[model samples]
Target: MQIKHAGCYRVAVVMVLGMLACHTNTRPPVPGWPEHFGFGKTATARQIDSLNISIAPDGKGLPAGSGNAVAGKAIYLAKCAACHGETGAEPTPNRLVATLHDTARTKTIGNYWPYATTVFDYIRRAMPFNAPGSLTDEEVYSLTAFLLYRNEIISDTLQLNAVNLPLIEMPARKYYVNDDRHGGNEVK
Candidate 1:
């Protein structure tokens, strides 16, 4: 009986050691990796500036350029009309404008987006569908103006600038509101 008890104790010790070793062996390697092994270099200020062209609701980060709906029409026809249709009333993938205020609406610049400056920001970062981030600051401003005017949010002559861009209230602002949900279970 004493011999059988000693053999059982040895088996238990062996199993514990085996489990510990298995756990220790499965740890991940050190964080640092060489550049050749798919690691990217640190981005410089200029590189980051080019990539992070985000605009705030207050027209912050707007470039030193200005344009109006008139100028935007030409650019829109040449570059945007193909995908967005003649008057932006016919978006290929998604409907942008409904000509006038349509009760049944999808996400569009006029009735869906909450801010006007977002129009410029979105165009500057990703637009023309085929070639994103290609339009100049002036071109982006022009497109913003055009979209706003087409949606009847602005007149045809209003020159969209950093100052004026923020002032133009979007129709969809009433729908959007700050997130009021707390971290707890309440989802309000």
Candidate 2:
């Protein structure tokens, strides 16, 4: 009986130690690698398209629809006022539009952004910080129009969308010049 009890204790101890050893030796796999990456094979074009929503300055990935400054004001009040402020003039956690009176003092969309498309692309990609990409294409257009109008860049009734969005000229557009990096040795 003593011998049996001792054997049972030894078996339990071995099992516990084995488990500990196995746990110590194992590690979680690194993410983003192919086989260790997704559930199965590579994603299809349609699947890729569903996720790839980034738009370019040349109107590359822009979706259809239009939005006006007046319509955008409502959307802004509903979705953006929490973070961007009521008039888009108030500085919340994030800077929305710049004040015309203090262009030298404040950095805003009107004072800093080089292109109108940049605003569209940025809002499309990141805005309503809490819930990114939540706004529809038309909402984004409206929001852009509203902000631009607040900044005095565009009229309140001006329509904004993929086609005309790129055409809207920004005040700070002239301030930007191409970065002429001659070589790695020194920047000219």
| TM-score of every prediction relative to native | 0.68, 0.68
Clashes of each: 0, 0
Worst 10 residues of 2 by lDDT: 1-10
Q: What's the lDDT of the predicted structure labeled candidate 2?
A: 0.76
What's the lDDT of the predicted structure labeled candidate 1? 0.79
lDDT of 1 by residue, 1-188 (tens): 42354346547876999889977765465679543466679887568655766678976566667899999999999998887888888746655674336764567887788888888887877788899978998898898898899888999898788778999888888888788877987666
What lDDT score goes with residue 43 in model 1?
A: 83
* Alpha carbon lDDT at 47, candidate 1: 83
Model 1: residues with Cα > 4 Å off, grouped in runs: 1-51, 180-188
**Residue-wise lDDT of candidate 2 within 1-188, one digit each (tens)?**
42354346547876999889976855555686554545778777568657877666766566777898999999999988887778767755466777545644557887777677777778778877889878888898898898888888899988886777777777777777887987888858
Off by over 4 Å in 2: 1-43, 91-93, 99-104, 180-188
**How big is the positional error of residue 177 in model 2, measured in Å on the Cα after superposition?**
2.7
In order, candidate lDDTs are 0.79, 0.76
